[model samples]
Structures are given as C-alpha cells and as structure tokens.
Target: TEDVEKIKPEFVRSFQFENKLMPSTWIVIRIDGCHFHRFSEVHEFEKPNDKQALNLMNSCAVAVLEEIQDIIFTYGVSDEYSFVLKKDSQFYQRRASEIVSVTVSFFSSMYVMKWKEFFPQKELKYPPSFDGRVVCYPSSKILLDYLAWRQVDCHINNQYNTCFWMLVKKKGKSKSEAQHYLKGTQAQEKNELLIKEFGIDYNELEIMFRQGSLAFWQKEDKNMPHESKGSVQNSHKKVIVEHCDIIKPNFWEAHPSILD
Candidate 1:
C-alpha cells in the first residue's frame, strides 16, 4: 500500500514545472479544430459556410464561457475560437496548461454533445479534437488589437474561400484551376470576381461569415419577487451572448464595462 501510494507521485510531481500564465495580464486561450477540412467533407458540411456547424461551435463557446466563470469574452470564426479571461483572474492559479487544456477539452466535449442537435442526419463517425494555447496581453490596447487581428484574418480567409468554392462548386472550374486563378488575386479583384462572374456582391454576404462571431458579458437586470410576498426584489445581473464586430471602436465603446 505504501508503494502504491508513492507509485504516481514521482511522475506526477515532475509536471510541476509547467509554466503559469502571467498575472495582471489578459489571458487568451484559443482553440482550433484539427483537420477540420476533411472533417467537414466527411460530415457533408455545406460549402463556404455551414450554418448548423457554425451554430454548434457557437453553442460550445457559450457553454465554455458559462462554465468558466473568469472568461470575459469570446470570438470565433470557421474552426477556431478565442476566449479572453479577465486580466486579474486567478483561475487554476493562472496555470497556462491547465487553463488551455480545460477550455479546449470542454469545448470539444460540448461540440460532440451538441452535434446531433445541429446535424441530426449525420453520424459523428469519430471523435473530434481541438488544439489550444494560452497567450498573455499586457495592455487593453494590445488585447483589442489581438481581437481585431483575428477579425481581419476571418474576413480575408472567408473572401478567398467564398471565391474558391464558388469557382469549384458553381462555375465548374477544377480545384487546381480555382487555386491558380486566385493565387495572385487581391481583395478588390476577389470582389470583382464575385460580382462580375457570379452576380454576388461580396459585401452582401452574411456578416457572421465575413465578420465572425463575438461573445461578451452583457448584464441583464431581473427583478425577483419573493414567494411569500408580492413585492419585487433587488435587480439580479446576468450575462448574455452577442454576435458583432470587435474590430470597431464603437463596439468597445458600447461595452465599456468589459474593460473594468
């Protein structure tokens, strides 16, 4: 029994060297699905955009934010999501590995749990996994910039994918031909291609695909009435989800309490 008790301590204690996230800094844990392209195809996801899959991802994100009390905001697009923790949070003693691993694990599990709700016709086939990392931002400005950068990436990639998929799916162009055609195309050229060739205005696409999904804590006041009496009680605050653009100053200005 004594040896059994000591069996794992030596190996387990070795993990104490894991790096902890910096205190008094923004903690961002980003998770991205592994080999999602093949996964999407195997599951018969709609090209360029899969509303059900996207909604499933957002649902998982909402679960993470709801379960992880310290998380302040989240932004996601395509197969990736980033969760922002409060700057002063002491979650899991600010352990980077624990925080990142737990968030990703929870998200992956939730995704699987809610998959049937979104795609009732498709079988899961195999388990899905996500890779995650924790990044620290020293200032609010840098944190804002980090989010803006993700939004910019979402816009660029969506535009390219829209064009590439359109060429292959709608225009009968070979995949290789589409890739070659888009290789040197700029944003303006992509816009022109969408408009002139497909009669689609790039700007008219769904904002979720172009801008991505953003989630933050918004306080809602609820007046509770005591069961014994007929009088209303004090306001109770709750958080709700919002999908919007985080790159603009107006958004940050509108949610000033987030900074506090």
Candidate 2:
C-alpha cells in the first residue's frame, strides 16, 4: 500500500495539468468540423449554404444551451459553433479543458443523433468530428467584438461562395475557372455580378446565410406557478434563435439581457 501510494504521486505529478479560465471574463468555446469540405462533397450537400445542414448545427446548439446552463449564448454557421459562458460562470471550476471537452463532446454527439431528423432520406456515411478551443475575453466589449468578427467573416465567406457556386453551377464553369473568374473581385463587383448575371439581389439573400445564426436566452417567466421554493429555480431557459445583424447596435439594444 505504501509503495502504491508513492508510485501514484510520482507518476501523476508528471501528467497532471489544468488550465483555468480567467475569472470575471467571458469564456468562448468554439468548435469547428474536421475535414467538413470533403464530408460535404461526399454527402452531396447543397453548395454555398445547406439549409438542412445549418439546421442540424442550430439544433445541436439549442441542445447545448438546454443542457449547459452556464452557456448563455451561441453563434453557429455551417460546420462550426461558438458557446459563450457567462462572465461569472464557475462551470467546471473554470477549467478550460473540461469546459471545452464537455461542450464539444455533447455537441458532436447531438449532431450525430439529430442527423437523421434533418436528413431522413440520406443515411450518414461516416462519423463526423469537431475540433475545439477555448478563449477568454477580458471585457464585454471585447467579447461582442469577437462575435462581430465572426459575423463579418460569415458575410465575406458567403459572398465569395455564392459567386463561386453561381459561376460553377449556373454558368457551367469548372471549379478552377470559377475561382479564377472570382479572383480579385471585391464585394461590390461580386454583388453586381450576381445581380447582372444571375438576377440575384445579394441583400435579399437568406439572412442566416449572410449573418449566421445567434442563439440566446429570452428571459424565463417569473410569474409562472411553482409548487415550492425549490421548483422556482430555472427549470429551463427560453432560448431563441435569430438570423439578423449582430454587427450593428440594433441587436444588442433590443436584447440587453443577453449581456446582463
């Protein structure tokens, strides 16, 4: 018994590691799909934007919020999602690895489980996986800016992909040809090209595709009947999804509780 105890401490000391997130800050755990481009091609996913695929991602996000109460918000696109834990959250003792692992594992499992719900006709070809990382923002403004950056990235990528796909799918150009055609094209040029060649109004495109999806709590009903004091605790949150501009002040003004 003495030898076993001495050996355990000597071995565990070399391998034990824990990186706690900074206190009084917002924690963002982002997960992106691994090799999803090849996976999407293999599955014949609709190009530029796949409604069902995005829907599946959103569903997994909703499930994450329902399961992880500390996570107050999530922003998700095609193959990636970011979970934002509250500023004062002590989830998993603020350990980065635990938080990242829990969220990523649950999200990946939910994605696999809900695949059939979104794609009933198509069988899942193979197991899909996600990679995750954790970062902490020192202030709310910085955190919001991080989200805005992601939204802007979504807009840029969607615009490029829309043009690329239009050229390839509609004009019958090869992938390389499409890339060459769209090369050196600015946002205005791309918009004009879409309008003139494809009769597509970029502004009228789906908001989710342009802005990605943002999910957050919608304030639980405090007036609801409860059997006892213990039952008054938040049984569940009212999580809502929006596909609108979070880059501007309008969204934050409308939902101040999201930051509160």
Model 1: ten consecutive residues of lowest lDDT: 233-242
Q: For residues 7-36, could you state the per-residue lDDT of candidate 1 as single tens digits?
A: 877787987786888789999999999999
- Count clashing pairs, candidate 1: 0
**Per-residue lDDT of candidate 2, residues 58-140 (tens digit):** 99999999999998889988798999999999999999988999999999999999999999999899999999999999998
Residue 77, model 2, lDDT? 81
TM-score of each: 0.92, 0.92
Question: Candidate 1 — which residues are off by over 4 angstroms?
Answer: 1-15, 223-234, 237-239
Error in Å for residue 41 of model 2: 0.8
